[model samples]
Target: MKIHVWNAFASNNSGSYTIVGRFPSEELAAQVAAELSEVLAAHEQWFRSPTAPRSGEGSRRETPSPLRAFAQVHSLTQGESDWADQGELRAWSTGHQVFLHDPCTLSLPDSYEEFLRVRGGKVETRIRHAHADIVSLFELRGTLPKKTKAETVRALVEELHADDGPLVTLAPFNLQPAWREGSKPGEPVLTVGAVFHDRDLATGFTAVEGLARRHGLDVTVRVSEEQDSRDSLAWLRPSHPPLKRKMFDVWLLEAGYSPKEVARRLGELRHGRYVDVPGLLKALPDTVLKRLTLSRAEQAVRFLREGGANAELRPAE
Candidate 1:
């Protein structure tokens, strides 16, 4: 029996941690389900029951706190009957096995292929009444708000977006696919949520080199490192020779053109082989560059060839 655990949080809520996992053994799974209900009941007793006074000032402390028992699982085994004596059952006795799975459900799409494309995982979506709706369970941890269900859903979506803000710190770690081609096992790949500033980038580069790192996976960023520079270059390129050449080189690099390939392409272009800059530009689609002074027809041609224009070729029209 395999199981996966996820750590989740909600906005305006206290520590309402929910563990969602699956079991292959029906008997083991059933035992786990029963254990969960019992644990939850114990939690209610400790946290919600008005009759239950605070611990240490308590009436013999009859009901053991669920939170305390759950924390004890780290040191205790599931097969141990001591946990059952303490108000929760042992997990290992149920002949169950567990594995880690990603917790984010926001990446799931209606189609399995689309889900894989976005999330890099294989998962089956199913609906079961007996299964706890983890999000709803988390929401129920505290006092219910007066807002309607629709409003609550809206708020939850907003919270997910806010939590994802940290993903933007991964921008500089985004390496090209070619760099990941022959990666070896257990190589240090950058995790998705890593944050990178200019200082962090320098440190990360050094660290990666020192460790001989290969692949990077699931990088997310709110803003790209190249965006502002790309925009500025778009405006400056057609008016400045150095900027024009630099922009061209950036475009080539972004298009995944090697120096040899670029030289070959340029050679072809020089000999009137009609090397397709339009097609190349379309494939790469540098919007910042397209918006610059090179957008002018005559300037566009000159910028590609002679680096903007000589003063004599500057058209009056």
Candidate 2:
């Protein structure tokens, strides 16, 4: 578990400050996120965002020379003790990322701006490089409960046999924080020891592992938790037929892809070498079946796959 803090605004031009961390495993991410809540508990006005909004505009242009947002009271809203508000501390897990956002705000910037206004003024309006309270931590905590997060991480035996997605998330916040020699500085050490639905676990996990492998980073799973999942409930019921890749993740690792590879990236489930979409665009492509929003990610991937399948029948480019 690790915590990375930046003493400035986050994306979406939200506020002028933030804390962050990335994990190869969802169980680990949940554990660290839970611990962050403990950090917030210990230090008032300190909230965590699964996804931070944009910043660096408005008066926040200048960096805070002496990072003090965490120690200083940012807003009256921060004074309000409302932990249960799905909006206040809402953690939304989508596709391959578990982001924290306030339901009350239309976007991340809304809440961030509130924090900035309450603190004093906007970041873009500032004229100097302020002290940033940023901290970044990159730690790899090996596998869990044998099959702790992975229904069968123990049975895994270096081979895939299950159909769970690459990503799964736990609301450690739903549970209490239990720390041991905090992994990041000025942050409590914590882990998600409870049980929660494995939402997008495969998706998130594999995406992470893929990046690690491509970069030659050594990693493995070691895996918790019961908590409400309304925030990411809809995702569990993906518009698609719960892609079989979840099932393939297990077998793929055994078939040859390293466990890290299985956890890090993805191809279409049915194809030994299916198309890999640019994960950055976590939306499904526009199709006749469903058109939730104007997104071309999934559509492009499909075109690539179907187009390749018929490439032999067509003339070479």
Best by TM-score: 2
Model 2 sits at a Cα RMSD from the real structure of 19.5
Per-residue lDDT over 1-317 for candidate 1, one digit per residue giving the tens place of the 0 to 100 score = 98999999874422111122334553654454455456546655556556545545524355445644553553332232112222221111111221111112222112212212232222232322211111110011112233443343333222222312211121221211011111234431221112233223323222322222111121111112232222312322222111111111122323333433443444332322234555644654332121112223233343343432111122221
In order, the Cα lDDT scores of the candidates are: 0.28, 0.27
Tens-digit per-residue lDDT, 1-317, candidate 2: 99998798655432222212234455655554454344334323222333222243234213221112332344323321322222243332212223332213222223333443342333232111112211111222343342342332222211211222122221111221111222344331212121122332333344445533433333332221112433222322222112222211011112122322322333322222233343312332212111111122233234334433211111111
Task: Mark the 10 consecutive residues where model 2 has the least summed lDDT.
Answer: 246-255
TM-score, per-candidate, Cα-based: 0.19, 0.21
Residue-level error in angstroms, candidate 1, position 38 = 1.6
Query: What lDDT is obtained when candidate 1 is compared to the true structure?
Result: 0.28
Off by over 4 Å in 1: 1-18, 55-63, 66-317
* Total colliding residue pairs, candidate 2: 80
